[model samples]
Target: MKRYLAYYNENHCENRNYDVVIVGAGIGGLYTSLMLPKNLKIAVLSKKDIYDSDSCMAQGGIAASIQDDNRKLHVEDTINAGCYVNNLEAVNTLVDESEEAIESLIKLGVNFDRDLKGNFYRSFEGNHSIPRILHVNGDSTGKGIMDALIKEVKNAPNIEVIPNVFALDIIEEDNKCNGIVAYYKDKFVYFKSRQCVMASGGIGQLFSKTTNADILTGDGIAMAIRANVELDNMEYIQFHPTAFYSQDFDNKLFLISEAVRGEGAMLRNSSGKRFMKKYDNRMELAPRDIVARAISHEIDKSNSNCVYLDATMYNRDFLKNRFNKIYSECKNNGLQIEKDYIPVIPAEHYFMGGIKVDLYSRTNMTNLYAVGECACTGVHGANRLASNSLIEAVVFGKRAAGDISKRINYDFEDNISTINTRNNPPNKGRQEFDVDFLKLRIDLKKLMDSSVGIIRNIDKLQNALNFVDEVLFKIENLKFNSVLDAEVYNMYLVARSIIESILNTKDSIGSNYVEEYSRHSVV
Candidate 1:
């Protein structure tokens, strides 16, 4: 693997400095920037538009222990969803700071939904014993919180949100992370800083069918792996049980939020018979891993391409108001959600394992933090519970900021800012072989979907690994013209990480499943 995907001569490059550099502009990075001291100069480098992160696409609400000592139950439910292999301390912190996280968002102008009495309406989702998921604008929870965060971030004088900057590698000198190398504005720029955080979202683009934004390319996790940072559970990828079955969208699949089922939707097989009972007792309300596996099995048993989500019991008014986005999407596709059986299929959703971090969201490397989907803090263990991702970003993002507050030495900022100052604009490095990246990316996604997808076997995993290695071998010496060249390598690294982790794990658990009788025993 190439340690640095960039070809930069630091002696003559467009170099800039900051007190802290965040490699993503998602909710985690934005919240971290907001929580940090106002005096610090922070730069949030985004791969695309500032608001293009997956956080804005989230439809379900953030989960928190709003009711009485539901904190204990929340922790229990989270652990249960992950099959009890979660880090006990990390889970405790996530639960303990639940209320504080929600309060922080509210104070920052995030308006969650509440009833006439002003009590927050807690919706139910799989794995939770009771209703605790908080939403805004019915189904636009991600956009709601992101709009508020973007406003706050823009107003904060110390934070700079730079779009169109694709972070290629974590820059380390003498075993300490000090900055990042990225492709920005058609040239390589070095962003040097005292501290750096990698919040660069999920690895969904590796699969052909995913409920993640296309911008999510696993850049953070890939760079961390190359840097030898400790990664905990790289194999625990969560596949959502219900994504709208359609081919109209781009590479991204439209997610059917778990909140739909939480509000009384039912799952049916191709024969239009409710089929979840044969798989689990909780039926539509089971944990995400259970539900996804159940759907996969049903699809196989019926030899059908999709199953049905029966939400026909609700009135049109209720459906429109409660699930306005979903209702409209279904209608546009010729299915009225209020009276039609919506076609659904399981799709790649979330990643539970990534660069390992402590309770404070600090990775193994000093002065480097990995927050959000990129950091495997172990709260989710084998699989993540519904709506916990949004809460995790803020709860731990605040902690990361708090930890940095005490550790940041203001005296060192002056010298590090101008350490390597020989100022000249960077040259576009040698453009080598231009491989067919478009075709390569398409094939890679299809390979991952077929081999490393929801259901897996030892032979398929090994074959997939070999295929990834072959692709990497082909591109190992190729030169780059666009960020896509570097992104494909990152994608392959993430796929290899997931597949290797699965091969090492002998037992089937959570979302990482292997064929029951195909050389690996199912747990």
Candidate 2:
């Protein structure tokens, strides 16, 4: 088989073989590269710039069971917040390895915030029994972690970082993935590897308003579905309830980290009343699903476009010092968070469901692994406890690399054959008439927002299913003029998959709710 790589800097295709091809150069991908065998030939692929990932924009911290925190209590809180449907094995893996992951981050030069007493300054979040979230770079925890990981990855040898490279589809040989078709610069190329890991993150861009970056177009979820991978709990998408709201659509729903509520911030409506108390005993610090549901209900009942997150009620000096990022962003957007009431709304943020993976980050298929937001290890279940996402990414990314290193070495196999491989015929790549997929994607997004989001009823879900089915048919036959077409095609696949998963579910749990059958028992 011939390998191809197209570079815009030089119009030449280079054929090569790598031991492992890791998709999406986010924190997970970066960490995976670092943990791989020192001699392994690894290629890190990305559709755009490497740093433009959902992980890089995370303003919150990583939740863990460090210090004297009780592991049993953390486990119970995670399971409870997951609506008791989380995979026990996956939860155990996360909680058991969390401390090690934190320690690893610290060793990698991630400076988590500490107090004057020289101890880790932890913060509380929704559904946690203890204050164990270790923050870094103040309100820029994601950037801090990503910065450290990226810097280390850049200095590492045997890792080929390929940015602006998009993995369109996986090439399967006899039910096993042999390689992948990647579009780089302006041409499609094939990359064969012994192992592949998908760390491509979530599909937040599908929504009109989200905190995700432009690259999070559901590529990982859509690619797995195309390869017939097992996906679980996709309907349990977590929408952060307190996204900063601005009139400009540029950054309309910037996420106000759950850490704020974890640190005693209040959620109030126009009546100046604390509404979360009416829903859950934990009040403003309840699980994200409960708080988001309450906020959505209030927004609908009051016929308002957004809600309010009152930070002024807290100590202004402390708030300013702690949340400088949020404070400055709000200030730049013409809102004084300390003096003026900051407008907020729920934004479709993280997807809890993805390619189902085991503790080793191995998917059902051979030689294929998934980590980070792209894989549903079942730790998040229906709703993810705040700050657990970052921790999960690093923990599993390390495990995936460790798992792969034990079996594979870093040398290229010269005698590899491609007799079983079949390539799409020339001129079959994408045509000009395939742009209708974009319009169809817009329709799906509107349908998802109106019907499949927040509170769901039988009628609306049925309507959403119908709309998605029609769109999926269009996507199946659609050609592509550009990568946007590819993105739309994948978006349709993910939306349909989420709809199908929702339909198969019999009971209301966490983010997935069907009012008429909410009480239905599967047994």
The candidate maximizing lDDT is 1
lDDT of 2: 0.80
lDDT of 2 by residue, 193-297 (tens): 889999999888777777888788888778778677788788888888888876686523678988888888788886667788778899888888788888888
> Candidate 2: misplaced stretches above 4 Å?
1-14, 409-434, 519-523
Per-candidate TM equals 0.95, 0.93
Model 1 Cα shift for residue 355 (angstroms): 1.0
lDDT of each: 0.86, 0.80
Question: Can you write out model 1's per-residue Cα lDDT over 1-523, one digit (the tens) per residue?
Answer: 5654334554344678888999899899999999999999999999999888789989988999975746888999999999899999989999888998999899999999999999998899998898999999999999999999999999999999999998877777556887887878777787988899889999999988899999888988889977788888988999999999986768798989999999989999999999888777888989888888788888887899899999989999999999899888888889888778989999999999988999889988988998999888999988899999999999889999999999987887444443232232233443376689889899989998898887787898899999988988887656666788789888988888888888998777787777853343322
Candidate 2, residue 173: the lDDT equals 59
